[model samples]
Target chain A: MKRIAKLSTLSVLVLIMVFVAACGKSGNNNNNASPSPKASEAAAAPAAESAAASESSQPADKKVVLGFAQVGAESGWRSANTKSIQESAATAGFDLKFSDAQQKQENQIKAIRSYIQQKVDVIAFSPVVESGWDTVLKEAKEAGIPVILTDRAVDSEDTSLYKTFIGSDFVEEGRKAGQWLVDQYKDASGEVNIVELQGTTGSAPANDRKSGFLDVITSNPNLKIIASQTGDFTRAKGKEVMQAFLQANKKIDVLYAHNDDMALGAIQAIEAAGLKPGVDIKIISVDGVHDGIQAASEGKINFIVECNPLLGPQLMTAVNDVLAGKDIPLRIVTEEGTFTSEQALAALPNRQY
Target chain B: MNRMFRHHLFWPLAILAALLLFNLFYSPDFFNIVMRNGHMYGSLIDILNFGAPLVLVAIGMTLVIATKGIDLSVGSIVAIAGALACLTISRGTDQNALSLVLSAVGLTVGLSFFLGAWNGFLVATTGIQPIIATLILMVAGRGIAQLITSGQIITVTSDTYNYIGNGALAALPFSIFIVAAIYLIVSLLTRKTALGLFIESVGCNPQASRLIGIRSRLIIITVYMFCGLCAGIAGLILSSNVASADGNNAGLWYELDAILAVVIGGTSLNGGRFYLTGTVIGALIIQTLTTTIYMIGVPPEITLVVKAFVVLTVCLIQSEVFRKKVVQRWKTRRYPAEREVSRHV
Candidate 1:
């Protein structure tokens, strides 16, 4: 019994250590811990936004608190976007009240309500889904808090619910990806058998990217998509799906991935089959994350359409503009750049996210 | 030799053989392996190399199921192990140092042991159901892993770490050697000693075994710990293969596959009469099915549907009642009177 007790104690100790190490690691990287009860940062958000726009603004000493509810850490791009928002909030001297939805609609709604309860000047959130937000938006409006949508848009049809939607146009992003492919093979004499690795089965990206690409390519008689499958926006699945495509089809010329991560995975699959990725299979991908940029520069991925995640400055700017009693546009699209092999080398150095 | 032919492993091996023959019909070059950069490159090699993780997890799962317990926590432990190992090595200035890689590996195994012990402790002392107890870690482990990696894919560039995942020796993947070594250790510990008997005895009749002076509690705890250890190694292989740790998707739903492998290997969830070889063949069948789906160009959504049908077919074939019903039909119609006379004699 004594020996068993001793063993159990040792095991507990090991578990504790593992947890401590884990917590300490993330805590170090997590720049913005939970917001404090008392706002100490002077001129939180509005004041900072005014500073960037104008040389002088009245009552700069008062703090502007902005509450931002984010969709949880679902992907690498989401994480990078979170980091950007947090950093921007701090730099803009805004007391930011941040909440993570963890990819749940209920959690996000709860967060929005909590932000309203706190009586923050403005409420901002990236809705996990497009529908079922009319009630929450109405609640925010009743609370006299303006809302700003970032990265993704809600399908509420009521544009009055938000002051402005500050993110990339999904349909446009998909069209950009397709346009590059059409330009590449306009003079193609043979059929371009393209295999697409889609995102999550029915997500916005998957739906829009598919339509966007098809809208452009379907018009061309020579361009045909032989197989379209969902890799679930994962690298492993991308490789598996690509491998299967290789087996069933004797000749596959073009590969289109909804995201850079999937494209990278397909590259590995293509290489394992004793063929060069960018050379033999003309690859086109989106997102333009660091890995995708580097892959493009290395000639592994052929072309990349950029979908920028750093919406901090734009989101903050819109909130300030609204608070200043100025009319802001309903849709504000951030400028994004595309990359080829030549352009990748020039842009790879500055591509942080 | 006759007894060997009648072993439980015989059927699982036969199933694997049938799958391989089916594969041959699809692609003639399925069995071919060519020497490519000192490593064998072909469909057969890929099946074994990729199936290595499943084999390791199923080996541990076999014992757990044999003891009438299941470790759903193995999948979570895989994520945790991969996350921590990558963090440890990535944090270090010298990722190439052999010492750094070894320590990282050691830390991952140690962490896995603790997770396993936790499950064992909850089930043995606290009397929580095995599924529910392990399920706690299964859910929490992914969140913990996410916290460790800070919700980002931690990609590391170290040849030493990569060697475990991508390195090949003697024209085979390093993962195969690692699985073999672990399997040898486990079998030797069981067969060469009285450990296997005690575990089986306890699993069969815990009250009787305890009355006979067998430590049933210790056996249960030990098996769960072993399962955790196996998961830790699998986690390492998975992360190393991609050279990154993805908390959300790393080893996602792998526990289901391991459970399926154990069940398909003919190990009863009711406990007793476990066969490691059977589990190995079961793991291969699962891997081959995945390989076949890709080879045949099945739609992504239909992949799961096809897998479910295959599993159903295998389980039906293994049913004793089904087999007896079919056999009894022939006898009942052709030799009903002769059967009655033989029974009486």
Candidate 2:
């Protein structure tokens, strides 16, 4: 029994190695270390030379193998982001190997290491967190594989490790929302009592969004946030918190939510309170999701600052540019636009996500 | 009156009352109920409305806990039930059609029963531990829900379905009526029949109950099925309230909340004795505390810490043994001579 157990364990380990090797070969067959014991029939030295020769013979025609790792599908915005990355990769005709890290830093690190071992042309990932990535990224840098950061950034001081970062600026998105609000209430005289529905506390987006909005709104002392509470960035919690806000304050002039879902939820609460949402209390929110834009077009949400999730096209372009040895900037911010109720109606037809 | 004070539900009720009283003092308008469009609107009503799903889940959890079983899968079941219902409604040409809405609800409830049976079978027949059995579904059920919704949030524009959550009847939110009805039925089913006794007997000792000719396995399965049914209804209310089903976020952490509600209601983890009324009050206390936090404008950073503190205080207050020990310690500290005399005696 002991011998059998040992044999089984050894076989399992072998199986895992083979699986990893095959996954690498599928992404790019140029890796010389991928031929497992099962593929020992071929002479190792000659196989390596032929593979290297084929690779050198037609390097330009070779499909640029790209490994992109993503955080898990935790929300609609994430799903949209994932869809865009996937669809645009197909459209761009890059040999793409995707991994979902399931919102775990360790998983993302494991995936990045695997991509490095597989030796895909480039490695791109949205870091689950800012820190604890120096070691793996160092390994990638030593391997001479250019890494690209998307959606989020790493906290490493060694900026040279990554070729470029492509994503929306969350603080900028928040500033846009606040900027629109300030411009709207510019000519108005009375104190604009705003009830703010924040996202999950301590989250990067939530904290940055709050600061950016506060920074912009500080220009107008008349714009005061009466109540600021975290709705945890969900529709139900947003509705429930908005209900409490409505009950606590008799007069609320504006509602600013961190995201569209919360803004949509607050619209329901506003209506239930026998007050018009866009008319009685102007609403400003971030993330131009379909549902939020629909609400905006209907004049329920006054304005929306879009935190665009469609980073695929720009990311593909950057990947191509990096492969071509072009010096791309360290930071490439995706083009995002703000939407009014009127603009929302016009953009509703062409909205992809 | 003395017996009322000693009632199993007394502590949970008192805690709820204290929380409400605190709210009344802190925010006098918390109790303000006004008739708007022939429907009641107030912070108090909001508690019952928003809390309706939790109340339903806890009511089911009360019985499951009585059988010495924990349903950690309730949260996942909530997500699945809502996802399936929304997916069905979204597929229909007319989302608002009553038939479509009814069928969606029926399908969701039916699937929940099957999921519950899966848990029950694993526990009762296969002899798996309850926690481990439910944990399988707890993890896998969310994936199943995600599959049902194709990993996307499904939004349905169905008013008839929305009525289950947002509509009011007789100047009260319709969700309150659904909760009250379920509570009534559960109370009657347990108190009026031998089923409750059988459950307690099985909970107390499975082998002994089997020797005594009790169908212990059936009892376990029945309670889990009933719990699933309750979770399914809760999922419906939650999805209906938002008019959308979020497979990822809907009913997240609900199982822990329901279990907390059950524990707060004086239900023992060891099983046997349970109080449905206590569970209801416990759910209300939780909802009331959340509302209080928002009304008082607790800083978002320390909100969780404040909630943990309140929950801990309530749990300590609920323990009679803890109370006696504290009181005895206080008496000893206040009078050293009395302690010496008692020691001599």
Task: Return the top candidate by lDDT.
Answer: 2
How do the predictions measure up, each by TM-score?
0.83, 0.87
lDDT of 1 by residue, A1-353 (tens): 97898788768757876986787557755546543223214224433664475323325677688999998765677777887787667666677888777667899999999999999998888877667899989999888899998987788877788888888877787888889888988999999999999877545677788898899887778999898888877776787678667766769999999988888778877876778999999999988888888889999888888888877867767767887889988889988888898899899886667
Query: Measured against the native two-chain assembly using Cα atoms, what DockQ does each of the candidate structures obtain, in the order listed?
Result: 0.33, 0.36
Model 2: per-residue lDDT, tens digit, A1-353?
Answer: 97886677568656855985675455433222232333232233223443343344336577778899987665677777776666556556667888777567888999999999999999999986677889999999999999999987777898999999998888898888889889989998999999899876655677778889999999999999999999877788899999999999988999999989888888888889888999999999988998889999999999998887867767777777787788999999888899999999999986756
Pairs in clash, predicted candidate 1: A44-A64, A44-A93, A44-A94
Worst ten in a row by lDDT for model 1 chain A = A35-44
Distance from true location, Cα of B37 in model 2, Å: 1.5
Compare the candidates by DockQ and give the number of the best one: 2
Instruction: Give the distance in Å from residue B258's predicted Cα in candidate 2 to where it truly belongs.
Output: 0.6
Model 2: CA > 4 A from native: A1-69, A93-123, A127-147, A154-161, A320-326, B1-5, B334-345
Q: What lDDT would each prediction earn against the true structure?
A: 0.83, 0.86
